[model samples]
Target chain A: MGTIVSILVLVLFLTAILTGGYNKKFLQRVQGSNMWDWLTTVDHKKIGIMYLGAGGFFFLIGGLEALLIRVQLFYPNNDFIVGDTFNQLLTMHGTTMIFFVAMPLLIGFMNVAVPLQIGARDVAFPFLNALSFWLFLGGGIMLNLGWLFGGAADAGWTSYVPIASNQFSPGPGVDYYVLGLQISGIGTLIGGINFLVTIINMRAPGMTFLRLPLFTWTTFVTSALILFAFPPLTVGLLLIMFDRIFGSHFFDAAMGGNSLIWQHLFWIFGHPEVYIVILPAFGIISEVISTFSKKRLFGYNSMVFATILIGFLGFMVWAHHMFTVGMGPVANAIFAVATMSIAVPTGIKIFNWLFTMWGGRLQFTTAMKFAVGFIPTFVMGGVTGVMLASPPADYQYHDSYFVVAHFHYVLIGGTVFGVLAGVYYWWPRMFGHKLNERLGNVHFWLFFIGFHLTFLIQHWLGLYGMPRRVFTYQAADGLTWINQVSTVGAVMMGVATLVFLYNVVYSRKSATAASAERDPWDGRTLEWAIPCPTPEYNFAQLPKVRGLDAWWMEKMAGNKELEPAEPLQPIHMPSSSYRPILMSLGFFVSGLGFIFRTIEVGVLGLVMVFLLMFTRSFEQDHGYHIEVDQIKEAEKGA
Target chain B: MKANAEQTKNQTAVQTSQESAWKHVTSFAVMIVLTAIAFAAVATNLVPSHLLVPLLLTLAAVQVVVQLYTFMHLNQKGSGFPVAFMASGIFIGVISAVALMILV
Candidate 1:
């Protein structure tokens, strides 16, 4: 199956090379840009938008894989997908969600909003930021490349050893998964460092740690989590890569190495990984809710503390996922309690949101609706989470439909919903035009209902002893009706997504040019201080931040504008270059070589990749500066 | 001009003196102790293999800490967050590896 996909991919590549229209045009345009320009493009807004567009594209692909899973599971004993095929769908769905959807979306939001919130022009490491994005794109492409070869990875997204062992599952599919994640994980680590440095060193003068916007604060902590969380994963993947490629015994049970090490390594990174995905969403919701409510976020310090506490606790509870694997009662009990304790900080965040909205004149825009909707949906998932935290109870629920329902509720309802809300909240900021409200409402309702219908009943199915990851179940199991209903919900989600796409495309063409100007929503944050379609260099001079909701503070003080921190100066901006893309391509080629070491073509490709990297490093170009005169002129026009 | 040149020469000499003194004393003392311990363990065989692994690991851990503080400058200014992040990562990695070792 994987081989067939590879053949198809080869065909597509050949076709793309032959047709040479859009793809060729894009390549030409990319080439026309100076090699150094892309390398140093220090514009935060551009990087942020690149993250959004790239992340959004991956989200669609992941979502489609999810829909395929739902379709296959819609009927009892259905053979719509075979066992290997089903495995691929499940694997791709999980991998895509973690590496593609969740990571990219969070990074996208961080890239887009972090600089604006902190009153900075760009991230601390602009070149590294660009590099991270390209590496991420390369990783994403490699992960999906399974479809073109023969099939996608058949091992679960976790790709537990013994199952993932070459003897049991002999293919390059798992290699793609490992290498894809390894490359993307590097991007994530780099991004985390960039944000950390940005927040620490580049905040506007007087915007101290305590004065930071919640979104920026969360970005800080999330970046910290990423810094701490990703190394174990890198170590684990390297070990696994060794085990597969070089015949190491890291996870070989027969060779006195333990398979459980992979689980520990994966989840050590994996558990904090959940917060790495959700905290940013939580940050987004905090901003959206407060802005729409017209209130200072209640218990702001507590909210900050809660974010920190959750991040700290995220590392402690990785073993809770291993309860059913039997690490003895003491270990299980410890992990169980630690896992449940996370709810306290998470609960504090929920109440803070509710209280912020208690008496304010609440505007129910699509973003707000999703924010409000997140409360109950996330609560349901959270409750199931507590239930699963009990070690003995988990014995029955582990690897069942209940586990699936629980996570989908949390991930989809919490993270995906938060991302959608962020998209609606920031749409005007990002693209200079609003997403059509009516269509947005339609998208939300359908998605909300569909999400509930699809996963809600699965809890009962699990209770009735339905195992997960099974391609089919007998009709006698009494899951047929619920499964059928779930299929309907899946279709509804599909319809909603289509409507969303339509809205995006339609609004782009229809919205008037002037409507693209900044602050269409009377926004409170620093991002709205700049003009719509923000400049490449965000501010001519940095704004002196006086208080929370800095822009709003300016308005209330009757200043009607921010005070500039300095005289207009020549803005030093990084130039964009193709080195990042080329560097990532090197890794992609090397990965192919590593996966198929016997092939001469693969070996040659590896050599070429190394040569490319060496050449890229040697090719140096310094960035140019945008003079003060140009900035002043642009400001005058605004 | 002669005085300034003399001062520059003195500064370089002093810097190199400090570096060499620290490097020689630390390496000789540490390497001797580590070699002695390794030989002692092999010769005596007092500790069992299971215990041996842990003991060696502990020694390695101590060595790592010392190296980080002295060589890596982890104890210096501006090293707080990076140290914290690296330590937490290593701690989590150890815990997870141990858990999986026992469980799976």
Candidate 2:
């Protein structure tokens, strides 16, 4: 399957190259090398697109895993995929969906939208941004490489210590998990720091913190969360790596190392990771809802505070997951309360969205549909979440299909829906074309209905004592009918994904007419001020943001364009470099070597990586500037 | 006019240099005194053994603040963002340590 997928991807790439279209022409401008321009490009927009493409590919792989799991469970006593293979499928599904699909997709949105929303030309460090993407891609490849090499990680995405230790499940599988996540986690950490710096330093004149768009504000908070959260995860991965590769005993119970230390470290990173993905989705939903409702976001300050509060409280409640671990009443009570209090802020956000749409012209755009649909679906998820927060109730629900259902409702109904809404919302800005609304609506409804149909019944299945992480159930277990429903719903969602893919291609072919409109949704944010097919220098002149919804404010004042934050001048743009990809490739090679226990190969890869770093330190490549005349010409062409 | 501007810039540069030199020397003297006091406390048994670790930690913390402000120039103009990030990182670090102490 991996080979077939690789071949398909290669064929697609060759086709794109040989077609001799605009991509070929663009490549020819860069010394006749087809991949050179894009490969070396440090443009945030291109990087963002690459992130989305890679994330979409992983999403499909994760989705396929999901379908297979559904099929395996479609009938009781099913032996389609039993035991360890099932474990691998489930583990890879969760890992890929969280790390590879959801987070990167949100990061892609951030890369495309945040700088634009804040009226900046580029991120604070475009080179680092490119490097972050490459590292993530490399890590993703290393992770899946385990599948081709006889096994994948089978100890679940959480990879609880005792089970993951060499004594029990000794294989290269968990090693792959550790090294892959370690590499990717570094990329995510740097990416977080880059955004924090960019948002702090690079906002245009008059774009104060309060005046910033909701999307940018969420990106800011999310980056801060990522900065704090990913470190513990890296430490956890490193310890496990040491225990496995170096034969240390950080997590090995026999050597007096406490197993729960890994749990603490993992969840310390894990809980905030939930918010790191969700906060950006919240940002996207806020943007889409307000734009479609044609009103300012109601209680904007409260919404911002809610987002921050959620991020902070996310850390306090990590122990809620381990409630049954006998943390005693005090710890359990405190964590439960922290978990429940999160609902207060989440409730504020839900009401804010509702009030924003109240007495306003509601445009039922595809993005708006997803945003609106997200409210009820997420509230249901939240309700279940609050229920599960109670320690006693949690014991009953823990590791059950109910727990699975609750998370899927929240993660799929909240994060996935938000991403789809964002993809529809920002498609025009990112790709210079609107997705076909008719196809988009079909995609939304099918996915929405399919999602509920799939997971909603599983809650009852959990109540009826259906355990999770088990491959099959006996006929006497009475889970057959519900499982069939879930399988059918999963199939519908698969079809919906196909339709969405079709819309992407269909819309691109018909893009010329729609691409002309800069403000496709009569957008409220600063990103809309730039012309479609955003020039390499995003804004010819940085926009002066006067108030919230800066573009809308200017439009209300009858201005055709944003007030320039600065005089028209040559734009200093960063030059592309090959170092980032090469460095990531080095890490990728090192990962493979470590997984295979090839010490010499691993050392060689490390040498290559450090050598690149040494050269990068001394290299002084002052980037070229975009002439003001070129900016003018580009604006004229647009 | 250019020469006048240049003279003023150079003058201010010299003045600030002298002022910063005085600051650096004063901070150096203060940090030395702090170190000496820490050593004296340990050598002379100024505090009970039970409280000594906390006292030393507090002294160390104070020295770190001084070093950051005086030597690292975190007290300089336009350093608010870095200060905020550092302060928050420290705050969260302390919080997490305390939480783990209690919970883990």
Task: DockQ each candidate and list the results.
Answer: 0.53, 0.47
Q: Quote the TM-score that chain A achieves in each candidate.
A: 0.93, 0.95
- Give TM-scores for every candidate, taking all chains together and pairing residue i with residue i: 0.90, 0.94
Q: Lowest summed lDDT over 10 consecutive residues: which window, candidate 2 chain B?
A: B95-104
Per-prediction fnat values?
0.82, 0.27
The CAPRI-style docking tier of model 2 reads: acceptable
lDDT per residue (tens digit) for residues A1-638 in model 1:
43333344345544644664557767676557664354435456666767777778887888888788878877787889868888988899899988888888878888889898889988998878987888898889888887876457889988888788788778878888988888888888999999999999999987888888999999999999998889888998899888988899998888998888888888888998999988998998899899899887888999999999999999999988888776889989999999999999999999999999999889999999888888899999999999999988999999999999999888888898998999999989888899999999999999999999988998998998889888888899988888888778888988999999999998898889887868876778889889777888887789999888888888788876789898778998777765566566656665665665434444544565577567767877577889988987887777
Q: Lowest-scoring 10 consecutive residues by lDDT in candidate 2 chain A?
A: A1-10
Candidate 2 total steric clashes: 0
Stretches of model 1 off by over 4 angstroms after superposition: A1-42, A598-620, B1-62, B100-104
**Clash count per candidate:** 25, 0
The candidate that wins on DockQ is 1
Q: Per-model C-alpha lDDT, please?
A: 0.83, 0.89
TM-score of chain B of 1: 0.66
DockQ of 1: 0.53
